[model samples]
Target: MSKQTQETGGAPKWSGSFGFIMAAAGSAVGMGNLWRFPMLVGESGGGAFVLVYLICIFLVGIPLIIAEISIGRAGGKDAFGSYKALNSKWGGVGILAVITSFIGLSYYAVLGGWVLRYIFVSVTGLPKSSEEFFVSFTSSTGSQIIYYLVFMIITVAIVVMGIQKGIEKSCKVMMPLLIVCLIVIVIRSCTLPGAGEGIRFFLKPDFSKLTPGVFLSALGQVFFSLSLGTGATITYGAYLGKDQNIPKSAASIAFFDTIVAMIAGFAILPAVFAFGFSPESGPSLMFQTLPAVFDEMTGGKIFGVVFFVLVLFAAISTSIAFLEVVVSFAVNTFKVSRAKASVISAALITCLGIPCALSFGIWSDIKIAGRTFFDLGDYLVSNVSLPIGGILACIFIGWVWKSKNAEKEVTNNGRISFKLVNVWSVLIKFILPIVILIIFITSNPWIMNLFK
Candidate 1:
C-alpha cells in the first residue's frame, strides 16, 4: 500500500498516460462505434441522430465514465474489489458491471469471428450475392463456432501477455492502424461519383426525422459506443497512474471514441449512398449491404480488404478489454495468476459464446422468450444488464460515495482544475440516472408492455 502502488493501482502502471489513453480509447472504440453507430445513424435519420448522440455522449456518457474511473482510481482494484474497497455494500454494482462485460463479450466474440471471416472473404473476393453469402456463412454452425473460438483464442493470447505487453502494446499498434485504415476508406468513400449525397445525409440534419425513437437510439449508441456500464472502463481506470488527470483523460477517450464512430460513418455511408443501397439496413448494413458496395466499386476488393481489417482491429481491441475485465476479477479475487485467469476465463467465455454462434443455424429454433441465443444475449446485456449497472453506478457515486469525493478523484484531490466539476456532479448524481432509467424501460419489451 505504498503511494506508488496506490498511484499506479499496483504495478505496471500503463507505461504512461499515453498508453493508458490508447488502451482506454481502444476499449471504447469497438464494434459499437465501428459497426453499430453507422447503422444507427443511417436508420435513425443520419445527421439528426448524430447530433443527439453527441448530446447524449456529453450529458450521460462522459460523466458516467468519469465517475467509473474515479471509483477505480480511488479504490485501486478490480471492478468488484474497487466497489468493495470503497463501500462493501455497493460491491454488487461492481459485480453487475463485471457480469455485463462477461455477457457482452460472450456474444460479441461471435460477431468478432464474423469480422475476422469477412477479412479473408474480402481478400478472397466477395461472393456474387452478398446476402446469400452472409446468410450461408452465419448459418454454418461448425464454421461459425470455429471462427468464434479462433477469435477468442486471439483475444486470450493478447490478454495472456499481461496488460502492458499485451493490451496496451497491441492497442498502440492497432488503434493507429485502424485510424489510418478508416481515413483511407473515408477518402475513397467520399470521392466516389455520388458520394456527396451520403455525406449530406450524414452531416445535414433533417428535423422531421427526429423522433423519440431516434433520441433513444442515439442515447443507446452513446452509451454502448463508449463502453459505459461495463466493467471495462473501471478496469482500465484501475491501471491509471495518480498523475493522470481523470477528467482530461476521460474526455480524450470520449473524443477519440466519438471521432472514430463518426469516421466510420463517413467510411461506410458514402459508399452505401454511392452504390444506391438503403441506409436503413440496421445490423445487416455491415455484413450484407457493404459487401455489395465493395463488389461494385472500382478497386473495391482492395478497399474491402482494408475495411474489414480495420473492423478486425476494432473487434480485437474491445474483446481484449472485455476479457481483461473477467481475467482481472479472477486474478484479484481468487489470487490466481494472470495467465491462468486469462486461460480459464477465455475458455469459459468461448464455451458460452458457442450457443450464440450456433443460434444462427443448429440452435436457430431454440428460444428463450422467442429469441435465439445471440438475440437473447444481446437483449439481456444491452436492454437489461448495462442500463441497470449504469443507473446503480451513478447512484453509488452521486449518493453513496458522494459526488464530491468522485470530483476529488477526477480532479486529483483538487490539485487538477475541473472547470465544470459542479456540472459533472449534477449530471452524475441526478440527470444520468433518470435518463438511463428511461432508456432502460423504453428499450425493454417486457417493461414497455407492462405500461401498455
Candidate 2:
C-alpha cells in the first residue's frame, strides 16, 4: 500500500498478491505456451512429452522459481543489481543474466514481429500454407524490418511508461483476455469433426515412448515457458511486499501458466488432427496448421483474426517483460532515468536483433555449429542462461543465505510450519540443481543433431 516515487525509486509495491500473480502469469503465459506448446507436444510424441514436462515442472521448475522470486524480493533490485547487491563476487553472474535477457528479447521481438505480421494477415485473409507464407514474408526484407520496428517500438513505449502504470496495468488486462481467447479457441476446436482424436493424442500418456530426451525437452520447456531464468521472475519479485505469501503465490502462477498451456494444446492439437495434418512439423506447426483450420472453419476468417490477435498479445506481453528486465538492469546499475535507460536498452536490443531478423533472409546462409543466429540465441538463453541462472539462484537461497533469515523474510508475519521450510530447503539445495544439470546435458542431442 505504500507509494514509492517512480523517478527516484522503483514502482510502488503491487496492490497485493493478486496483482503479483497477474504480473507473473503475464510473464509466463506467452508465445511459448500458446504458439509453441502444441507443436512441441505433437513433435515430441504427444503424451510422452506432456508427462515428462509435468515431472520437470514440479521437480525443476517450482523450486527454481521460488529461489528466483526469493532472491528478487531480498535484493529489491533488477537482475544485475540484485546479484551485485547479494555479493560483489556474483556481479559477473548478474551481468550474464542481463545479457542473456537482452539476447532473449532481441530475437524474441523478431518473433513478435512475425506474430504481428500474422495478425495482419489473418485480418486480411489466412495465408495459403506455412511454407509459402513464410517464404513470401521473408522475401520482402522491407516489410519484415518494418514489422520488427513496430513490435520493438510498442514494447519500448510500454516499458517507458514505468512498471506500475504500463507493465502491471497492461498485463492485468492482457492476461485475462489471453485466457478468454484461448478458452474460446479450445471450445471451437472441440466442435471440429473428429476433434476427439486430437484430445486423446494430447492427453493419453504413452509410457512406452518416454525417454531421457523427452524428459529433458519437457523440463526445458517448463523452465523456458515460465520465464524462470534470466532473472525476470526475480526482478518482478523485487516489487513484492513482505506480507506476500511467496509459496502460495508462486504455486498460483505456476498452476495458471500450466493450465493455459494445457488448454492451448487442446485448442491447437485437436484442430491439427481434425484437419488431417502432421503435428510433428516443429516451428512451422502452428503457422502451417492453424491457418488451414481457420480457413476451413465456419466464420473462419473472424476466428483466425481473433486467434492471431491473441497470439500477438501473448508475444508482446512476453517481449515487454524481457525488455523490462534489461531496462531495469540499466536503470538500477547506472542510476539513470527510466526513459534514458529504456531508449538506450532498446537501441542496443534493436542492433542485436538485426542478425536475428536477417536470419530469415540475408543471414540465412550463415550458421554457427549449423544453427542460425536466431537458433544460437534461443539455444544460449533457453539452455545455458536459464538453467544456469536458476541453478545459481537456488544455491544462493538454499546454501548462501542463512535458513533462519530466509524463513523470516519469506514467511513475514504468517506462520509457515518448519516442515514446509525444510522440504523447500532440501529441494533447493539438492534436487532442483541436479535435475537442471541433467536436463542441460540431455538437451544437447537436439543441438548435436543440427550439426550432424
TM-score of 1: 0.96
Q: Which stretches of candidate 2 lie above 4 Å from their native place?
A: 1-11, 39-52, 413-419, 445-452
Q: Model 1: runs farther than 4 Å from truth? A: 1-9, 42-45
Q: RMSD in angstroms, all models? A: 2.3, 2.9
Q: What is the C-alpha lDDT profile of model 1 across 296-360, one tens digit per residue?
A: 99998899999998989988999999988898889989999999999999888877889999998
Candidate 1 collision pairs: none
- Best TM-score among the predictions, by candidate number: 1
* Clash number by candidate, in order: 0, 0
Error of 2 at 259 (Å): 0.7
Position 110, candidate 2: lDDT = 82
lDDT of 1 at 50: 80
